[model samples]
Target: MNYFIFGGSGFIGTHLVNLLKEKYPDGNIYNLDIRENNHDGKSKYINCDVKQPINLNIVVDQNDIIFNFAAVHTTPGHPNHEYFETNIYGAENVTAFAEKFGIKKILFTSSIAPYGASEEMKSEETLPTPNTPYGISKLVAEKIHMIWQAKKDTERQLTIVRPGVVFGKGENGNFTRLYWGIKKHRFFYPGRKDTIKASIYVKELVNFMLYRIEMDRSDVEIYNCTYEPAFTIEEISDAMMKATDMKRTIYKIPGGVLKFAAGIIGALGGKSFGIHPDRVKKLMISTNISGKKLKESDYQFQYSFEEALKDWYNDNDNLYLE
Candidate 1:
């Protein structure tokens, strides 16, 4: 059976592709993405964009699985239309491709953004109140996938995972920024220490994905992908400090003071001064999510937050030492 991965060049996709290669070395792997492969040349790379109808003359097998991870996810980085253009249209195109090939199984990596900036711990059953364009787009994409699954309910399999901030090797996002912050001794608490930042290590994230794929469930199963009893910013920072034993003075600045400085910098056409207005605003919002269904499942959490940090830290000292 072949594996088709959309956005396989991205952070999560790259790691997922690695896992696939190790597990199914002989299986045909196809990566359809706008970017180049982030791994050694092992899989078939197709320069395809999902914003439009995909024209793949590939030898798609009946048992092949499709993983749709394509989307514009950067909140402060993307224009409003870009999210819809990539996420909404990409969903339609991917589902169409799956239908075209009669592929019955699909796993989608959605975000906890759909739950909005809520401080309350939410589960899969929680009603979504997505305020951002990115969140709205993902919520709509979920429905698009659901509609596809509904059409062939008996035969098809669909699994959806809504993960929080996923971090690990090759991830140059939030955790990377945090690493830099701590290393440079510039990391400071953003007004609130208790802000819940629900997150998971990328390796652990993919492990859960594989768990769902191997499960006997069929047709419409959605689970939030986060460590239950999420960590506060202070807690996360402390874990990092202990993991690396880095000596850095950390303190909290008044929210109003930082917000005011951010406004001036933002108005001056500056993205940020390590204090973007948008980033600062996002700092206080909590992502206290509950992976209730996952907790109730037979799958166990193999990697603790501390273990993840230590693994990531030792994986590359260059990232921290630099």
Candidate 2:
């Protein structure tokens, strides 16, 4: 078996490569990414960009599976045009390459952003009402891959995963911010503690993707990948504190006060403290996403939020303590 993973230098991609290598050591795992795989030096890195035509300087076998993890995913980070340029065009390039190479399977890591920010918990079957540029682009990308799957018919297998905030070691996003702030004893919420942070550990999310490919029967199985009964800010705080064995002070500023502060910061064009109007609004909003489809498939999660926190603490105890 051979694996051709696009954007394989990313956080999820890196971990996925590690998982594949460990699971199938005999399988030839090729990372077709513009950047080299920093996490695994043993990985066979093929220099290719998904925005352009992929030319790995080598031929891809028909049975080789492709995993597309490349995209401009960070919201309020990239220009609106960048998302469409990278994500949509990237999808086009990937599917075209797959068609040309006769690759039979494609696994894509899309985001829960397509469902947009919702107060109620959303399932995989929920109507996608994407509001942001990132969200819209991802939805379109999924469609592009689906079109390929439809054209290939029964011969193709397409697994699309819409994961909520995925976090672990080396991922310097929302969760990392929380970890560092909490470690520094400066972690606090801008509003109520009940706001949901629908998330998954990086290892488990990757595990589920591999499992879905092997177990699910559908030609195309789209799953909303995240922990069920999503962890709220309070729960997350409690887990982190317990895991670290630290009794750090957690303050909750009033929403109105936070908005006022964000207004001033926004006027000044400052986003240094991980605070801004948009971020403040995001903190207040609840994204209660469900992974009922995976659960219904009899998939078991290896780690809960608490267990994941402890595992993370164990891995990075020195960094967290220092």
Which portions of model 1 miss their true places by more than 4 Å?
265-274, 318-322
Badly placed stretches (over 4 Å) of model 2 are 215-218, 262-272
Across 1-322, the per-residue lDDT of candidate 1 in tens digits comes to: 8888999888888888888889988977788999978478767889989998988887887678999999899878988999999999999999999999898889999999999887788989999999999999999999999999999998888998999889888887777777777776756777888998889989888888887776655679998888877888888888987888876778898877878877897888864335477877787788889966787888888789999888888877724611
Per-model TM against the reference: 0.95, 0.93
| Per-prediction CA RMSD (Å) | 1.8, 2.1
User: In order, what lDDT does every prediction score?
Assistant: 0.85, 0.83
Q: List the residue pairs that clash in candidate 2.
A: none
Q: Residue 294: error of model 1 in Å?
A: 1.5
Query: Which candidate leads the pack in lDDT?
Result: 1
Clashing pairs in 1: none
